[model samples]
Target: APAPPAKKPEIKAREGFEVDGQESDDLPPVFTTVPTKEKIVFLTIDDGAEKDPAFLRMMSELKIPYTVFLTDEEIKDDYGYFKKMQARGVTLNNHTLSHPYLPALSYEEQKHEICGMQDVMEKRYGKRPVLFRPPFGNYDRDTLRAAKSCGIEYAPIWSEEVFVDHWEYREWDQDLHPGDIVLTHFRGTDDWDG
Candidate 1:
């Protein structure tokens, strides 16, 4: 049998964005990429629109680690699918309650969307996540403030995006890099032409 996966390294937040476990005046940092030189890229899947059993089995067998940001509206139909993922050690973070564009909503509205999901996740998943991702990678100051108030410590966007058949890059080099955060949606053949 193959060797067990190595223990993951402790991830330290980028300087000036570190959380000291105490409240601060600054909003949580919004970073598109991490600060590191390791030859590793974080995979983050957004929305819980698809619940393909084969995909779940493949990832489990392959031992690929990933993080998920779920919108309550999309996953409400099958929370059990994600509960299985959680049991397998996948960390599910907040993607708001309805995946609304945070920049368009009032501060109170944004809080409701973010905090509401925090409550749902805590109630359903047994733990609330400290990380959050604003829908569509869009956010304003109010969005960050609301997320902070909801106990979100980091709000990261993506440096690259992957689809069923193609990839998108935000950098001019158009290539993957160390510490990059790659984004993908919970989609299958039903949602895209694979």
Candidate 2:
């Protein structure tokens, strides 16, 4: 056997957030932190505008784990790129079909945006994601309802966003917590070159 593929390190789940069979009946568990004392943070990248091979190679070599929230419009052009990332153990989640502001849309419209993407994702990726992140970190009660109806179990917004040069914090203290979620994006050199 070819060295029996190396086993990846298992991620320790934060307290109060069981990794298996943890379900909620109210609002799909909106959270910004994982509620743990461990000095580990979750990485989430939103949008799929850039499909750089170099980025994939770097991430694969480093063996970093992250989730990607993909908008259909941006990623529909080159989903195979994402499939390659998926092969490397990245989880693909839903952003939306058009990246609309969910709060501005009606309940039906919100359902269409979310459920539509769910269908597309299932067809393309062979799995329906149970996690969703609303666009621009904006959503309302209806958005949560729509996500629930579409079978999403969690909705997580970032506590901070990491840019090429600096970190943007949502808290006044401007410090990172133990289980804080960090957000980034798929951008080419043009978007971050400045």
Candidate 3:
């Protein structure tokens, strides 16, 4: 009989957040946080409702790196705004075509929503993204299948979400952990007074 393939060894991080180093080609990557001892956190901004130049300036001055998950409907009116951010080295990812609930839709519908956004992002930003976030942080098995078919490499949900002045935590501790992914949306003073 033929010998079975040896298991890939896992690489441990010295400090800070690290993803499991074991490589698997068949499985799609789904992550909430990278496992590590470092005190680092990742910030992800969803939607594109507000295009605040001051906010951009502040983030740029702070040198914070965040990923933006843009919806076509929210950003089509001011695509140039995101273009400026992209020029500043910020990454723009896919949220969906119209921000529909993925689990509510069929697999083909889900694929259309995701792939359509990918087409728009590539046409507007000149690069196809490999990161996706379903609308309302809702998805199902078909969503993953659709995302994988569309070439997404990672799908992550938030550990915490921040509004204009307060934070909402998914964890009961209400405290941040290493490699935590934070979520925030684009909103103006109308949405929540700052």
Candidate 4:
């Protein structure tokens, strides 16, 4: 048998310049807070309305609330899956259109990406997301400002997140800590759910 791969920590690092809708080609550093006295965690899924039926079913049976960030590009195929889950629980957030790397695009481009998706989701499901999640956890100054102007207050990401089981099952071991956000994808995902 082959040796198993080394387990790397899946912590999302950010910079102080973490802004939304910037074209710096580099995500600004970030600031993260550790909750001192709380026992809760947040599990978030990325992309929109995946076609996988089993994952959808698993989501419903899990009986836990999760946040879903949608990029307009992902819904070009339609968002039937999302519309169904919206009724169940999954709260939607704004990702962007075409899943462009926000930090790599100019300020104007970044704003368009984030705000554009907000419009798409609102029009499709009548739900406007109040949170933003940048692709690949990357962001710069431009990214942040654009998101805030769009009514987003938080840059939601995983606290102690990882993919397990062939990278198919998205898992976040928040250890039941408060304000813990988990990250996952929808279509053609590479999460190991172990």
Candidate 5:
């Protein structure tokens, strides 16, 4: 038999891994969702509280509910305008105290923006919003943690958004789907007869 095999070199594996006190290794490399229900989906939109009359009429006519993540700045400019829709089952969520590029801000600053929105939305709306959307989709790890500090669940993120800023003829095609989170910066005065 070979001379006692040289004692196997002691091997060490990573004992633990954590970042920001969250287990780094325990987390999935990415987060994804699986649809649990057939054809059931949620619609979400962000920004624009600056007196868009056309969007209001369209929303009124459509008579379908959608969630809007509103910035404090946008709401402040005309915050009261949302109350009518709030009564109509439209969900209001916090985007930020003001639209800020959350990832670029320092940790404390990000916390301020995220928490500020949570605080104000609760005061103004009678409930703390459970959703948050980073302005311009600018977010980082800090942004996520800051949002969680308050009672916000991750808001919906979209890879594509259709902006109908102009009231063009094509907007009224009526082939819209339930899951499509349609976005329009402003609206036109007349209805497009489907």
Candidate 6:
């Protein structure tokens, strides 16, 4: 019999980035980047429109660690696709039920969009997500409030966005910094220009 792989060390949240009991009502800390000097960046993919097998194979082969923020409206089409991703040790977080522009929605509507997805995730994925990303990176206070009510503890916007052809950065310098959160969508050649 072959030797089993060694267990990986746990990654802890940075100081002041802790979630539980850190805020009143547990409203999630919103940030575009994690404050760290380590040579590490976070890769997050949004939505669930594409189910490219090659992408999954590449990530798995590369041993890349990434997170997925899924919208029920898109992922409900193929829940098993993400299940395979989960089996790869990926954590699926909440985007929303329908990926609506949350600021325009009333409080109740926003809660429905957020909390409803939390329910769907718990039912289908076996865990309620603690992280959320608002659609289009647009949100308001009500969005955070609703998300907190749904048990979300962190809401992150991207410091950089990755498209097929080029990358977009939030900073004036077109470069990546330590602790930067890079965002990408579940898009392929048909959806973006290469």
Best by TM-score: 1
Q: Each candidate: what lDDT?
A: 0.85, 0.83, 0.80, 0.65, 0.59, 0.85
* Residue-wise C-alpha lDDT for candidate 5, range 62-172, written one tens digit per residue: 875677888887678676677766876778887898798777799899989989988888888788987677777566667767777787655445423544343222124
Q: Write the per-residue lDDT of candidate 1 for residues 89-151, one digit (tens) a residue.
A: 899999999999787899899999999999999999999999999899888778878888978
The residue-by-residue lDDT of candidate 3 on 108-141, one tens digit each, is 9999999999999999999999889878877766
State, as a TM-score between 0 and 1, how close model 3 is to the true structure: 0.85
TM-score: model 4 vs. ground truth: 0.71
By lDDT rank, best first, the candidates go: 1, 6, 2, 3, 4, 5
Q: Which residue runs does candidate 6 get wrong by more than 4 Å?
A: 1-26
lDDT of 1 at 94: 96
**TM-score, model 5 to reference:** 0.67
TM-score of the candidate numbered 2?
0.86
Local error of candidate 4 at residue 65 (angstroms): 1.4
Better of 1 and 5 by TM-score: 1
Q: Each candidate's TM vs. the true structure?
A: 0.88, 0.86, 0.85, 0.71, 0.67, 0.86
Ranking by TM-score: 1, 6, 2, 3, 4, 5
Backbone-clash count (model 3) = 1
Off by over 4 Å in 1: 1-24
lDDT value, candidate 4, whole model: 0.65
Better of 3 and 4 by lDDT: 3
Candidate 2 lDDT by residue in tens digits, 88-184? 8889999999999888999999999999999999999999999899999887777878898988878887889999899999789999998799999
Query: What shift in Å separates residue 90 of candidate 6 from its native position after superposition?
Result: 0.3
Number of colliding residue pairs in model 6: 0
